[model samples]
Target: MKFFATCPKGLEPVLFDELQALNVEQPKQTLAGVYFGGGLEAAYRVCLWSRVANRVLLEFHRGPGETAEQLYQSVQEVRWLDHMRPAGTLTIDFTGQSEGINHSRFGAQKVKDAIVDQIRDETGRRPSVERLRPDLRINVHLQRGEASIAIDLSGDSLHRRGYRLKAGMAPMKENLAAALLYRCGWPDKAAREEAILDPMCGSGTLLIEAVLMAADIAPGLMRKEYGFTFWTQHQKAIWQDLIDEAEQRREAGLQQVKSRFEGFDSDAKVLNTARDNARRAGVESLIHFERRELSRLSRPTGEEAGLVITNPPYGERLGDEPTLFFLYQHLGERLKADFAGWQGAVFTGNPELCKMMKLASDKTYKLYNGAIPSQLQIFNIRQRAVPEVVEVIDVQDDSAEPAEPTVVELSNGAQMLVNRLNKNLKQLGKWAKRQDISCYRLYDSDLPEYAVAIDIYGDWAHVQEYQAPKSIDTVKAFTRLQEVVAVLPQVLGFPAEQIVLKQRRRQQGISQYEKQDQTANFMEVREGGCRILVNLQDYLDTGLFLDHRPVCLQIQQQAKGKDFLNLFSYTSTVSLHAAQGGARSTTSVDMSATYLNWARKNFALNGFAETRNHFIQEDCIKWLKAQKGENFDLIFMDPPTFSNSKRMHDVLDVQRDHVELIDLAMGLLRPGGKLIFSNNYRRFKLDPQLNERYEVKDISRQSIDLDFKRNQRIHQCFELCRTE
Candidate 1:
């Protein structure tokens, strides 16, 4: 007989080793499973002993299936009576697609029809389809117009170890947990009687699997049913002998095993569930479960070093990435402080987050937890290095004032940058104070060598380094950047960490909206009369555009008693100002859901009712084109220079599409209402024909604020009203 054991992707090699250990012959590895020639004894052994196999299959037939009809005929040709009776319940699992069979359900339906029709013709009683616990689970694979059929020997996936009656959030599958242990060499550690620990062990899957491996317990012993139990070829005597042998081994291993395990989680409710799962796995006494935070993680009492393995949250299931970064950092700190001289392994889907751990891993193994590509990083917890301190000399002065600290040496270029920054601050600081502006640009590429835009939000500065040209020396540019960062703390009075640094490259399409980091580090700053939140670290542009300050204020001044529409309303700061100006209704539209969500939070922050204010998340052009009636008294439009986002039906170029966009906005405006059109494209030219259709006035000068006066062409603005 031939058999196949299926496992998760990237576990083929490990599954092959497992089949070889089970004494199966010619175990050949495939993409996500292993195939081998084995008898009933070998097949039953794999079903009962293999920890990582999701399902074991008994190969039945290989035939041609060029079409759905051919597939039905191929399935009907199989000797159905040899495996299952007519009255038995069965289910068909069809995978892969052919030119003729594009849908899996359609293919599965054909296979079912073939079997039921054959069974009914032969015995006048067809088997009923049962989704759960069927007597025979038929598996079919169609590839390149060929079909391979098999009977599932393991009724449910082997990962369903039956011990986990309930699971906490983002629980790791039992087989994936087993694979992690095998990759981390937990089996060898168990032989040495070394303990195991998991700091963020939700529901104790890892701990339970560790204890089972150490105790030489068969993972399938807890399962109550097998797919072969009701099969025609199943021999009760052969299976009973294997079961008896496994039972004896289980008893002996339980008595002789000496390794211990511990699992900790912050949620007490999840700890209760972990304890219950451990009880069900029959390893409750050998493992300890506790509710503890990652910060308080320490070694088990009176135990030597062991293994620390955990599957922390990977931002998809539980918490956000920024918080999870601290979680990983604390995990590393605790491991270094308490678990030195031990081995550690972290399994996570977000591999980039492991950089926060601050420990060097010696090995990394790629694995998959379902569809999520994951990695298991193994590291030895060595002693941490001590930090060197710089000694300072305190010199007594006759004036009795505290001696000045060491002055940081700056290069000539850095001093030039310092002079320019001070000059701008001295001139703009008083103007900003008078205008009550908390967020404004201090310097925009003031010096040619140090090409960067330094903007201050309240006290924290946001510095964006423009990508240097190839002619500049890379090392020189880097040194200048270091000087710029070094001088900000002294010149701006904000700490270095508070100054968020980002590299600005020319962005295309909606890449500007793509997250630079998952750190949602938002700070609230006062802009005009309203409070606006800006995330300096997470994107190329902050939530609020400093150049648009005047545009937003202009909308606010003219927005009273008007229904306002804001197109391409990135974060809707202008709409917020309009709402503050007592607009009867405010509508904001943008394609990026992230920005729309930010706008919603801004509205909530300002205590604006969602009922009066509307935030529509759609492409502005598409939404505007879909509208038919006049709806707004005032409209403000600021569009990107160019966008070819996948979500948009067509690419948008502001210069080519501005006339159409303006016309669309005007179509929705009341006869007497006006439209304020704006774009950051420096060389934008208004369509000559638009001037003949409406009264177009250039407000570009009025829209340019004092801080932006140095860069007069930062943006262009216009006011368009119908000429009756």
Candidate 2:
């Protein structure tokens, strides 16, 4: 008899080896499971002993099911009377698709009608359909035009294991846990009497699975029922004989077991569930469950080498991702500090969090937990290499310095970036110092391959990589980005921790202003003789716009005892400059309360009284329209290219709304007052009627500084005044 065993997607090789070990002949590999020429005894053995297999299936029939009629005819040929009585319960699990049967449910319904009609035609009775614990569970798979039909022998998806009465949030399936253990080489460590540990073990699924595999206990022993239990063809004596033999081996295996299994979680209630699960799995004494925080994780007592395996939360459903980064980082740090010389494995749905671990994985296996694609990252844990101590001699004379700078070796791409950075610093550095500009753009995609904007804000570097085109290979782009990050510290004289990295995609709505991280790490930087605070880590923007430096300075230079109005005033940087330039009073308006609060801080930072410099939290368009009659000598309106914030009454598209925005702002301007309008939309065009009506001078070139001269489209600035 030919049989098939279904396992997780990424563990086909492991399952193949397992079938061969069980003496199944001619095992062949497929997408999710393995096919083998194994008789009833071999199939039963797999059903009883296999740790990773989800179900053992007995092949019933195989044929083409191109059309719905063909599929029904093929299923009807299985002789339904031979497998189950007509009075029994039935269920069909259909997967894949064909030209005629495009839906799994429709395909399953056709297959079910075929079996029920065939049985009722001969026996005068039809089996009732049962989705759970059916007497005859049929699995039909259609690929291309072929349909492979089988009877599901092992039921309840083998991952149930008859344990885990209560599972924590987002618990991993037991079969997936076993597959991850196989990928992490846990069996070898167990054989050598090594220990296993899970720091974030929720409900003890990993611990229970490890103990069951190591103790020679059949995973299906505790199951009360299977698909074959009610089938008419089930051989009672043969199954009972296998069960007795397994019971005997389990008794002996428990006595000989020496490997330590331990699980730790922070939740006491979940720890109780884990202990109960271990007890139900019959390994309570062999495993230890403790309610210890992950931050307090340590190696098992007296164990030198073992495996530290865990399935940490992926932050997909429950936790915030930025906080989870620290969790993964702590897990890696704890493993390095406490479990050196051990093997470590982490299974997570979010692969991006793997980078936070900072451990080099020996291997990574892509698997799935249900529908969520996950990764099993395996690492050979070793002690962190101690830094070599070097004695530093203090120079007695301040003038005495190294005769020549040390040149470090780098990759070709990194060397190219280094040379470009040096050239830019040589030219822009002198200009920045001469102009007393502390914040400036050093390089903006100078090398097309390194498509990142490097901005220097005092001692820190904020690098924003433009999202590469889809035509570029993702891995190649990432490698180039890595080279850029590795080369920046050496080239720019800043430590790695001082550099903040972010990826910039085209902004939608107000998402560009959304906080990326909670670390409000602000640093003071000087520009245009005013003190400004820039947060490099929290948002995509650094609270200060480096490209708008010249424009803000122009506003300050023109504002002397003149009332100023700043609209869309992000962080109020321009308003602060205007206030410092001796503006009589300044009013800053924006839609974000966060920015308005930040503007309040900026005014406070500059020692400007909040009573004099007003920060209004309202939509700039609505605020401008609501003003009955207002007069300001200088009004600066710099709106986003587009804003569809939920707080806004309507969307603000610069190209479509610039004319109305300029006219509204001009209404608040006095007779001779200037309305400096600007936006970063590259294709923005001022209305010709506005130029015909008012005196408009395009100062786009003058608004750009020496650093941003190469990118003339950074922003378009126009000064509008009344011509009457």
Candidate 3:
């Protein structure tokens, strides 16, 4: 009568919404799980239609635990004979959080022993443990000394769905990949005249899910057995009725098949796997599989509008940054040149690679592949005319020595200037980093009035302070940025996306003599369950720094039973880690409501509890000024380099305000509390002006990364504690 549907950490809300849409009533959320009341028919329906759930579990019993003896006695109390015959095979799976149980495997063994012992004592025979396949599958969950037992209603994880008979290397699970497609707004209709394409379709999970949805085919139709079918309580007529209803729905959907679905993979073997998978799903006639490299892809004929969904490779496995960049550059050029009227969806673990596509995306959705948080960026490409190039005359180079170098007119006009800068980026970047200067002035001019600066860190570059010409006839700055990026791979041995561009715009209503201020644009990327906010192809100053990745992991490890407090929390990175780690509750405080809203999106993206985690839109100083006694067990305090928001009581500077902030934060910690304080202002000096009331330890060594190897002191971190 009662069941639980289990999903990955960040997909609970998606699964819950899906269940509600199916009219499954009264679904309750749990930690990394959900519970609902349903019959055998309902359970079977959920397995068939629920796209987000990993597995469906049927609850058997819940009782208080006394000891190992009590747990064994409780196991024997269940009427196992009602579901499993004495000669049938049985298996037990255990998950424990209670102090009474030290090992989940051991607990499972004990429960299995009790079940067989009871059956043998009563009937003279006991079921054997069948690991591969079993007649009955039981599940046990122990938390805070209480145990809840259940039967696994789905024989295998619901992701299997029985449709995938063949798979390629590193194939995504069917359920999760399906959820991603659904999130992208791919409708469930066959004859909509829209097309779906996966450029890098390893085993074609995305294409297969699309075809199944378009045909209104239930995923559970291919599976031969369900856990509920083995139960004595399973009513044949009820299951028959459910199957009949599903068949009617499928038949109604059969008339609507008008769209085309296809996938392309460079590997021939993977294409074969995709074809086989389609055949198993009975949609082989409706889907196409092709073997082609990304550069060789061509637009489908007579299609004015379509959706191009793809999962491109990140450089993590390839380890060649230059090659990766070229791949991205080619990909961008292909889309721009061929698919002029198509809307595209690109899913990538690397933000840098996404930038190489060159087209501006209208919407971005965040999802996870295992622990890696990733973005699914949607692009709407429309036909537009290319603008003609223009040239400008002599200007003085301000940075050059006396007898100022004259800017020479070049043949290709403005195009030559863009090409030269693109070439210089690669040449000068390697030279500057080798010289140990992270930031350097590239060009400065007052006549034409363009000041250019570059920040080089790791293998990436950030172009800052590039001002567009004020003349109304000048090309748009975005067009210039795209031009520079197109030649980046050739000049710098890096991809176009790896070179981030920041624009400088003149302030309105100001004197013509006033200098323009610049602001850098950064995109957030998700990798391995973590959200990394940074300027793609830019230097180390990511909006959300990755150096604190280890710190977030540490918080995840220590989150259970603790109330977490994150101060100056930009985008709530630590809070996400705490929630994923199973913390009781979390409160994130940041001065910027904008960053707080972004943090909330990250939580929603990862399926964290919105109510359990609160984002405070107030200055941490003001919030701290209003607080009194020690409360939080785990705290993260990372301040900005310098900020002067009018709503704040005082100007916030990390270097100048570290001591006072540390003291105030220490006073708010509970006994044995752990506080992590960090800052990115280079050449920072710790204040020696404060008393030693708390123990402080440097943790910067644990935060450095290979990707950020060029900057040795990019950020500094400290572990502080109040003395007992």
lDDT for each candidate structure: 0.86, 0.84, 0.69
Instruction: Write candidate 1's Cα lDDT for 35-111 as tens digits.
Output: 99978899899999999999999887988888998899899889798889889999999999998999999999999
**Candidate with maximal lDDT:** 1
Candidate with maximal TM-score: 1
**Runs in model 1 with CA error above 4 Å?**
385-724
Colliding residue pairs in candidate 2: none
List TM-scores for all candidates, in order.
0.58, 0.57, 0.54
lDDT (10s digit) by residue, model 3, range 319-435: 234335435545666677777888777877776777756689888877776777777788887754331111111133558653322233333534565554555555656655564
Worst 10 residues of 2 by lDDT: 386-395
Off by over 4 Å in 2: 385-724
Supply the TM-score for candidate 2: 0.57
Q: RMSD for all candidates, in order, please.
A: 14.9, 17.6, 20.9
Which scores better on TM-score, 1 or 2?
A: 1
> How far does residue 522 in candidate 3 sit from its true spot (Å)?
22
Score residue 553 of candidate 3 by CA lDDT. Answer: 74
Model 2 Cα shift for residue 405 (angstroms): 18
How does candidate 1 fare on TM-score? 0.58
